[model samples]
Target: MVRPRLTIYVCQESQHGRDPQHEHEDGDSSTGTFFVYHAVYLEELTAAELTEKLAQLFRVPAQQIQQIYKQGPTGIHVLVSDEMIQNFQDESCFVLDTMKAESNDSYHIILK
Candidate 1:
């Protein structure tokens, strides 16, 4: 299935606080529901490249995959579609930062 880019919406939000250009469609924000994340790029791979890769492997729209970068080598927070989750048996398998990412750097992957 070819994932069209038109359906993909990439907007920058201030992780916190209020901004007019946050692009988030939440006008009724009487409550808080946003959480910041820590990220890394040990492999130092671009999120755009990884996103396309995962989209193809997971058989979903590439734009659907979301990644958040932090001040780390390879500890980025990734959020992908449920459909993508079904196809996580690929060569890339990412683990949590709490765990040691030693010699296993080769297996490091992105999960948003």
Candidate 2:
């Protein structure tokens, strides 16, 4: 069976001391500094595991990840925690839909 693939656009900016909530409140658009990644997986992953994968891909520390957001029809949806990712998968069928549609929709990973 072919593994499911996800395309993510990870923001290169470090959150550091910035407020994660307010990062996008001012309506700032994408900086075009993202490191695009195509992640293929056969099994569902926890947020920490996802973070570890991203850290390896980006060569950054996992702890530097402050949050992860998925772009949705309504708005950006947060998936920074295990519970949140699980709830998102359950409610929105994110992984299934991505697998079916082969959508290249970006998942934003905010670094600290």
Candidate 3:
């Protein structure tokens, strides 16, 4: 049987808060560094599970993720929820906003 798969682009929020006006002016609404993720699902996945996967990918605690947004037209960010994931599509892009104010370069590395 074929398994479900998705190709997603994940971006870390910039240290500076997003400015819609500036993004529009610059004409590059999606300007941040994005990491491509190819996810394959053998079974159904939940929002919490997805969060954990993202946490692992970014090397940060899952709790640090404050919000997850689906990038819309012109860089509009739409809040992602369980309901949203129910209808999630392949090749969608998302931006991760963490609780900390530091840049993504400052992500802690925990040695296990």
Candidate 4:
């Protein structure tokens, strides 16, 4: 059977403090710097959904999938099969850093 394709975009909060503009003028200090990751993408799935997808895609146990998320935001983790890595590597995937964006449609989309 043909498997459904998955692509993931990961971003982690920076260890450094929040940006001065986001804290002073915006009056939002809770948000810190977030860095987008370019590699190791997964199919955009939620907690429960991803668990199931990982099981079906990789034929692994539930505990393994849970462990991936527990890895924390410091690094990106994906529980995918060995065969999928090569196949999906060429696809275009991205993680948008929209914290500083003002409007919903402000971001640009480029199709290649």
Candidate 5:
């Protein structure tokens, strides 16, 4: 089956941990509408492990998160909704907390 492409436009204020959804009227998922959270970042964690962690943290089934980057010791992005993103940012939950990790290997979650 065909699916919609979700290329996130990382908001500049993503690191601030604030309310940041700017959906457009067209109801587009990736463009001028909808604050769908796609890529999530977690510091000091490998993409593979981070993916697993996200599934557990969100109580999701499995294989929900996917590794987008091949290199660089950065955070992992967990696929989620705009609402979930808000929660993550507000609570600095599993994904947002990664940005504060002391290890450089850690990752910071981002929407893709």
Candidate 6:
């Protein structure tokens, strides 16, 4: 199967609440356009666990993932764009008060 490329563009202009699909029409080409793929929603991931998971996901060494995690949110931003947070929220639900909190989120990401 073929997958559609995930293209991301960051514009210098102040714009918000715009749909990703209509980004081109909303801004000038001179801003900045980036090409990124594999943005994962972060949930039920502690810094330690996230490091291991990221290493596996990116097929890189665990030390590299640790370095990124140590850099804090900025490093994570380098690995994944913040847009995935909104994408996750829009596409998922977290029963925080439930007994099986992680199960649902994990299931949503892995299976459903």
lDDT comparing candidate 2 with the true structure: 0.44
Model 2: runs farther than 4 Å from truth?
A: 1-37, 42-44, 83-112
For candidate 4, write residues 1-112 as lDDT tens digits.
Answer: 5443555444333445866665544133566544534333344334455445434544555544332222215544443334434344444443322221244322221111
Query: What lDDT score goes with residue 13 in model 4?
Result: 34
Give the higher-lDDT candidate: 4 or 5. Answer: 4
Candidates sorted by lDDT, descending order?
Answer: 3, 2, 4, 1, 5, 6
Candidate 5 regions with alpha-carbon error over 4 angstroms: 1-44, 68-112
lDDT of 3 by residue, 5-90 (tens): 54455554343445545553423455632233345341344566666677777667886665556656666667666676667676
- Listed per model in order, the count of residue pairs whose N, CA or C atoms clash below 3 Å is 13, 0, 0, 3, 17, 0
lDDT tens digits, residues 1-112, model 5?
Answer: 5432221222221322332364443244343333323353444334454456555555654443332222123644544543343333321311122232354434434433
Angstrom error of the Cα, residue 1, model 6: value is 22
Top candidate by TM-score: 3
Q: Compare the candidates by lDDT and give the number of the best one.
A: 3
Instruction: For candidate 6, give the lDDT of residue 47.
Output: 43
- Report the error of model 3 at residue 82, Å: 1.4
Output the better candidate (2/4) by lDDT: 2
List runs of model 1 lying over 4 Å from the truth: 1-44, 68-112
For candidate 6, write residues 1-112 as lDDT tens digits.
5442322121123435545665665354454442222333345434444345545654655654322311233322222233433233333322111112243322111111
What does candidate 2's lDDT look like per residue over 35-79, in tens digits? 222443413547766667766766666666555656556654544
For model 1, give the 10-residue run with minimal summed lDDT.
Answer: 4-13
lDDT of each: 0.38, 0.44, 0.52, 0.39, 0.37, 0.34
- Badly placed stretches (over 4 Å) of model 3 are 1-43, 91-112
Residue pairs in collision within model 2: none
Pairs in steric clash, model 6: none
The whole-model C-alpha lDDT of candidate 4 against the native structure comes to 0.39
Q: TM-score of the candidate numbered 5?
A: 0.24
